[model samples]
Target: MYLKGEDISFGYEKKNRILNHVNLSLGSGELLGLIGDSGSGKSTLGGILSGYINNYQGSVSMDGKKIPSKGYNPVQLVFQHPEKAVNPRWKMKDILNEGHAVSQDILDSFGIKKSWLNRWPNELSGGELQRFALARALSPKTKFLIADEITTMVDAITQAQIWDIVLDIVEELNIGVLVVSHEKKLIDKLCHDVVFLDDINNV
Candidate 1:
């Protein structure tokens, strides 16, 4: 399977465009990196690919078919800020299981404690919440993952731990990943190929 974005273009307003005529593709089980400056619309492209933003031009398809608008999205997106992505009112367990029932093995792999499940989102550290966010996103039905600077807020040790577990799970599941970040060293280490947004985005 493959995820392809063709002639993609987007703008917050008519005069200013964030992305323009950008094309990108990722194959199943492939690890790809998207690198660009902080405000160069890397996250916008990721959002377009993952079905979060729908007001863009061009097509985003998987295996030559349009991605479905309803139902569980196979293309899952994990944001840089886990707190913003989840509901603060919900307990950790409810948030973790919002999409589907995550396996106990996945929880263990992410070092998510059983006790943390009962706590509120704010009670846990950013790293802890990110672990749950990732665990939830890596559901069995997920075909592709858009990781947008997912470890930017964590320490080096925590970042390494998170990526290690994520890489292992994605490998086992054959899920494609698009690692979007400004960190060149991390992109070089994790991705088989890298795409610079400036090279592809004609804005």
Candidate 2:
């Protein structure tokens, strides 16, 4: 399967354009990188691709078909701020299992202790919360993952560990990944091929 975005464009206001006729594609099992500066609309494009933002011009499709409007989405997005992505009122276990029954193997791979499941979102550190976020996003139904600077808030060691586990899981599942970030070094290290936002975004 492949995810393709063609002639995509969006803006917050009429006069202030962010993305302009950008085109991108990612095939299953392909690790693609999208590199850009802050406020360059990389995250916005990720949002559009993952079906979070719907006001954009042009089209986003998977395997030449429109993404489903209901039910579990094959394209899952893991944001930089995992805290913002989850509900604070819910416990970690509830949040983790909100989408599907996250397997014991996945929890074990992320080093998510059973004890952590009982704690609130605020009780865990950013890195710990991020592990849960990733674990949750990488469900059996997920076909493509759009990771938007997911490890930006974590330390170097934690970043490496998270990526290693994620890479393994995606490979095993043949899930395509779009790694969006400002860090060129990180992109170079993780992706099979890299697309600079400047090169694709007309605006």
Q: For residues 117-173, write the lDDT of model 2, one tens digit per residue.
A: 999999999999999999999988999999999999999999999999999999999
- Candidate 2 clashes between residue pairs 3 or more apart in a chain or in different chains: none
Q: What is the C-alpha local distance difference test score of each model?
A: 0.96, 0.95
Worst window of 10 by summed lDDT in candidate 1: 12-21
User: What's the TM for model 2?
Assistant: 0.99
Model 1 lDDT per residue over 47-76, tens place: 999999999999999999999999899999
Off by more than 4 A, model 1: none
Model 2 misplaced stretches (Cα beyond 4 Å):
none
With candidate 1 superimposed using the best TM-score fit, by how many Å does residue 183's alpha carbon deviate from the native? 0.3
TM-scores of the models, in the given order? 0.99, 0.99
Local error of candidate 1 at 123, Å? 0.6
After aligning candidate 1 to the native by TM-score, how far in Å is the CA of 37 from where it should be?
Answer: 0.4
